[model samples]
Target: FLRAIGKARLITPLRSEGGHRRYSRYQLRIAARARELVDQGTPIEAACRIVVLEDQLEEAQRINAEYRRAAEQADPPPAD
Candidate 1:
């Protein structure tokens, strides 16, 4: 499974001393999600790309929210 995904350049797990592939929690989640998408009739390549884009969009939204909070903190409202 990992080998196929690795070949597709989706989730690149690290290799241990014994040359065994080791995946992190993040990778596991991604793999599970890709599987879900594939099971939904999505193509393997498209599924991987969709998962990656979704993750990126979520991260970008999170960063934007943080920046908004920081900006609000840096500038206080007028006296009430």
Candidate 2:
């Protein structure tokens, strides 16, 4: 998966006392986003740019709004 997104070099294996590789939450999120974008027809470089470089604060806000609306509609409160 790392190689597929051209991040084989960036992804490093973490060593624990037991010698197990550990990945941080942020790294996992980045990998997941990369896979998603790649599957959506975005080139690896462009996917990385959009997910990592481009400012996504506004896009995040819009997504949050949509999620909140969906949650509200999913189980609306009962009438008094």
Per-residue C-alpha lDDT of model 1 across residues 1-80, encoded as one tens digit per residue = 56767777889999999999999999999999988988899988998899899999999999999999999899977898
Most accurate candidate by TM-score: 1
TM-score of each: 0.92, 0.48
Runs of candidate 2 exceeding 4 Å displacement: 4-13, 16-21, 54-80
| Prediction-by-prediction clash tally | 0, 0
Which portions of model 1 show Cα errors greater than 4 Å? none
Instruction: Quote the positional error of residue 31 for candidate 2 in Å.
Output: 0.8
For model 2, the local distance difference test gives 0.73
Writing each residue's lDDT as its tens digit, candidate 2 over 1-80 gives: 76554454434656799987677786677778877988999877777777665337767888999999999999898999
True lDDT of residue 36, candidate 1: 92
Evaluate model 2: give its TM-score. 0.48
